[model samples]
Target: MPASRDQADRTQRVQLPDETGPVPVSIVHAEPRWFGVPPPLLLFGLAASLFVLALVLLAVGSWPSGLILLGLSALLTAAFLETARRRPGSERMRAAHSWTSSRLELAREHAKRLAEVQGLRGRRAVIESERRS
Candidate 1:
């Protein structure tokens, strides 16, 4: 077969069956699964509760201890919020890394298959030339 015909055959699209009927999906990728509420919300809640407890301490007679608790709560809140902000980006990075690695693996497999085909073609061409000579 000619190269153009082979190329067209490889480029042909296939339809897949789904609940919505036949869909022409090319590249299949899925979003990462979420099991529960994000950690940041929980961390912020904890910080808020701590701040309330510190206020209660201040209302009572422990000024030194209340100040300490308030400072700690502030620190925890800041850390948790920062972590929350970076969490999505980091998760996305990991997902992107996984996607990139999979693509590389697919490319490698395709290259190997193409090399095998080219090797067979070269052998066939050599035989044809020998026959003609």
Candidate 2:
């Protein structure tokens, strides 16, 4: 029917095993951009590579090139550190990490309480059985 076709055109539906009928889900695509700056890890990797190359050059007696590369590597490393410090999602990442740690602590405490309760229940059951006997 025209109504069914219109509905189908408006929303894509998917059949789920746990659902009674088709569910419509909206698809979304998000693109992440670094605002024209290279990722900190990439810069760090380049810096490390440069440092290794500099060491190799120095071992091969290329003192001038080696010194230059060494300086460049140091500069790149500084830039990488600065970028990583000022990255947009760094605070969010830290917050998420702290939140996860707190949640883990809470879960651990809950588990400990549950274990104690289970142990007490088991002891009470044993005592009651002995009394009955």
Candidate 3:
């Protein structure tokens, strides 16, 4: 049976350090082959074209050429599947780690700006009170 779309595409919730506390982030795990392999469109197109060429060769009475092309196409498809199955989980983890780190840095920067603004507001209130006295 084929794997479901949910199984192929997984989402993980990661806790990243922030200025205030740990922040929960949802990270969608994209295709494993996205960064490592050729585009799916290109791979599929090549396989399909090869299959079609094989059929055309067979129609033209070139049995040997047709068989060779068919075998090549099958091998290409199997190689792609094997690559996907053997892809390391470490790559995905690394990508998620980088994404979380960047988000955490942004949160810290925002918190720092907010703290500065609050400090300015407090100073203004003190000045106002002194003037009223």
Candidate 4:
């Protein structure tokens, strides 16, 4: 049988606070790959251009134009990716948002709660007393 909802929620999940330092105040900078997504229009346009080129080459009975188009397409793709990678100050903006957001705040709160539990372990009375305080 499948697991219950509470067990499913608690188990098989990495506690985010545990991954970082004590107090969990450390910045978890998002990975670059997390922000990277291929532009849909770009993919669509490339497919359409390739299809058109293939049709044109077939009609003209020419291998050279097709080969040249392939080479140019490869070159252009490389250039486009390189340009996108630069991204005009995007690195700085990402760095700023990563630490300033609620994500970091929630991580800190989780860390604080985990620390309280760890500090009060092996003594239920102590846990109750600490809670009162």
- Identify the leading candidate in terms of lDDT: 2
Question: What tens-digit string does per-residue lDDT give for candidate 1 at 1-133?
Answer: 5566555557657886566867577897775544553465555667778889999999997989899988988776665555554564466544544554466589789999999999999999999999999
Estimate, for each residue in 29-63, the C-alpha lDDT of model 4 and write its tens digit: 76455255454335335644874785688678897
Candidate 3: residue 12 Cα off by (Å): 39
On lDDT, the stronger of 1 and 2 is 2
Ranking by TM-score: 2, 1, 3, 4
Every model's TM-score: 0.38, 0.41, 0.37, 0.27
Model 2: residues with Cα > 4 Å off, grouped in runs: 1-34, 88-133
Number of colliding residue pairs in each model: 0, 0, 0, 0
lDDT of 4: 0.58
Candidate 2 structure quality by residue, lDDT tens digits, 9-83: 687579757865788889997756669778776776788899999999999999999999999998886676666
Clashing pairs in 3: none
Residue range 52-119, candidate 3, lDDT tens digits = 99999999999899999999877665554444345534665345445544665897899999999999
Q: Which scores better on TM-score, 1 or 3?
A: 1
Arrange candidates by lDDT, highest first: which order?
2, 1, 3, 4
- What does the lDDT read for residue 92 in candidate 4? 49
